[model samples]
Target: MDDTFPKIEVLINNLYDLKQKRDGNFEASVKRVLNMLMVLEKGLWRTTRGNPSSFTDSQVEKCSLQLWNWAVAENTLSTISDIDNAKFRHVACKLLTLSDPSSINERRVRLQIEMCLNAAQAWIVCGRYEMTDDLFELARTCIEKLLDGLAGQHHSLSGSKRMMLDRDLFSIDGLQFQCVGSLGEHDKAVIAFNCVRDKLALHPKEAPFLAMVCYNLALKFHKEGKLEECTYWLRQSYDTGKAEEEYKVDSCQQAKTLRFLAHVCLQWEAPHCWINALNAIELAIKEQPNVPGFLLYMKILTLSEAPDTDLISAVQKILKHNLPSDLVFNAVRMVMQNGRESACKTCLPFVCESLSHTTCGLEVILLKMEVALHFGNEDEAKKEAEDLIAKHHSGKMLKEMQQEHMHLLLWGRASFHIEAKCYADALVWYELSASFYAPGKLDCNLAKLYRNLATCYLELHRLNKAKESLSKAHRIEPDNPTTIFLNLRVALFEGDEQNASHAMDCLVQLANQEKDSVGRLESLPAEDQETPC
Candidate 1:
């Protein structure tokens, strides 16, 4: 026997004696065993076996099983603190040795894995990511072993043990989904997502888990550019999760899915899809009414090709709810988009008041710039922009604060120049805008900037430079009709009949695809108005 075997036997006997005495020394005995377990856990990291008492692979397995048996007999284990209760410590020690396969047997491995699965769940409940990852690996190994055993025709496990194995398999599958999602392995992520869905199908009562799987599948589909499939799963997630108040599903999740759906719709130029996004926002509000949802909904409604009057009522409701400064700022954007300048003016004071009450000082300055520009008060806009620049340059803001504030300042200046038709000045401001972290990878905005630059060059009759800017815009967005039209004009003016003919053919094809009266009329030449393209 190993030297540590003698010490282990002594500790086991002492623990049994303490249990028998029942002298209110239970806590002390548990702590001692916990300390000993900690020592053995640390030993897994050591390269040298210090003495005969040091636990070998077989002895560790034997002790872990004996410890579980003792815990079953004592019924004393309550928490990880009750290590002397044996079961908890044995599982904990086995988890520590999972990377060292030599220290665990098949049966002990299965028990240890079950215990680690429980521990991992507990850690998840506590929001401990590091511990959750450790326990998750142990659980995964256990489930993989069980799968292998089943494949080899091991004796069929019964009842709770079989259920436990199934649950562990599901959890491991969920973990794999998270791992693949984090690594951006969207293909593998989708496969794992389907596996989870299949697992959940076997147990339909697990609504929360099913919702999570659906949510993940939606995200993976979105990444893969499968818009219809993405929408389907997103709706499934929202529908499944919305039924459970106990889960307290985050409204942000629903809101994000809605927002992404709206974005995909916009990309596809599908007006009906935007209505679906609006519906989703309403559903999200029904689940958990909040300012962010209102803000997102308002933005979507404002951008809809056919704005609904009900959206206006919704905005009024949002304002009545007293949304935060940022949300109110978005409300201002919606109003501006709807050409409700007076409504924007009315909301200005409330926006300023909310900003003053918050610690986000620079945001207030930025909002002032926005309101000024919206109201055609260029002087006020420039003043706010200069003030913000001075404040940031004087080290009066945090690094993050400065970075955020500078972008607003630059954008305000850019908008001012663009509206004033001072395209040279606009180019300078846009160059500055390029230096900031774009909030949404706004390639559309960049494309617009290039288009504007191209227009300015065209005005100056610099056809080469105009072509260069238009090429940049086209590279960013190949199918934008406006860019195509502009490029066609450039070709015509440059007398490149071949290029002009090609651009016209593309425009005619797009016009035919639209199947609208205006599109057909636009495609016809001035003298050929009676003829179709």
Candidate 2:
């Protein structure tokens, strides 16, 4: 209803209904549904100034009421138990497929693999192992494709997607050190749990995930009232988390462990666990109370209904210190959480300076760009981008990284122009950005990007360019009415009666499809309440 993905939502609904029926080949329908979900996911997740409001499940949902009814029964979403007992799981397995890559986009391939992994995981959680092997195979294929993207001979290690694949150059005292970024971890774990029973002891390298797994197991035990086991595993998890810092290996996100520890202390009722969790986070205050990691912990504590006096003191301490940029940014997130966004905006300068220097740092700088766009600071954003490009073109980051980064930077700059209604400038930036996409790799933004280009060209009276861009968009997403309508505009602008007539005919056919879908929904029994317009 918020119109986050208005045009695609309609297509998604139609596909949702088709997939749920007792007729036709469900495999095709399921793939269609998954493909649409993947597209919608990417479209809605673009950068925003502050917190992204479009990220919530309800805001970017996959299932419609008329289809995937299993997902709608419970607030947490339908589980295995929610599946219709009447239907055979083999039948369900036939329908729940690993969708093929809709486009050659690296992100799209990643999403395809993720979709399979997610489906396999849900089935696993529901004790449905029948389909995991097939599902895992699908995930494995995508990962291979992902590696191919990373391994292209011409693609230097500097590219953003490939950057994570680079082995960081750090070592100490006869031991190699590195950051974590493995796509195979999920399928490997699933296979190990399913088939490999006599595996070796947990590897030292896997300690981070071990801690996470143990902590989650502890929560499960706690729910089952097995307090002793719960407490033991929680301690193990906490100890492992503590080791992460000393080890200097990037297993978990910064401040995640402390936040988790604090969450348990505040949310769990058990006094023993509470004390341990509280103590763990409180100890962090001694290390760097003015740092982002510590301030984040303090922010977590402040969320408590009955925050301790010391917790309140920690927050005050953060304010008194001339903190580092990252800490100030963390403070901004905290301040914003308390409904003080204006105060956070005032702290953006510090946030911009906090970006790490080791990597291409495009993502970090993009955050600043987004905030600038949000606050309507065009000059500041433009200046920031210019300085970044200066550093990039000067070989601060590799040319390959600069090349990949240029696309995202262009897209960000285009967004700024769009906001100001500078259509010509926006079109140029988008065209440049779209050119930088990896050859053969599908860009999720392809359709929308060209569609915008078409609009911009039209505004400038460049009818030929507008028609060409719209045609390209049509090739990417042929069925989308939004693209079709814009294509109609191009045709009309050129006074091409044939193309205009064709576009209008297509629109009518699409409208009829929707009308027919509605009629079917209306005919269903009133109790189903399954239709979603």
Candidate 1, residue 207: CA error in Å?
5.1
TM-score of 2: 0.35
Candidate 1 structure quality by residue, lDDT tens digits, 323-374: 6655665666677667766666666665566566566566667666766766
**What would the TM-score be for candidate 1 when compared with the true structure?**
0.39
Model 1 ranges off by over 4 Å: 1-58, 62-107, 115-158, 201-240, 243-273, 319-333, 340-533
Q: Number of clashing residue pairs in every model?
A: 4, 4
Residue 332, candidate 1: alpha-carbon lDDT: 67
The most accurate candidate by TM-score is 1
Model 2 stretches astray by more than 4 angstroms:
1-261, 268-280, 284-357, 360-363, 386-444, 456-465, 471-485, 502-533
Top candidate on lDDT is 1
TM-score of each: 0.39, 0.35
Model 1: weakest 10-residue lDDT segment is: 524-533
* Model 2 worst lDDT window (10 residues): 172-181
- What would you estimate as the lDDT of candidate 2? 0.50
Backbone collision tally, model 1: 4
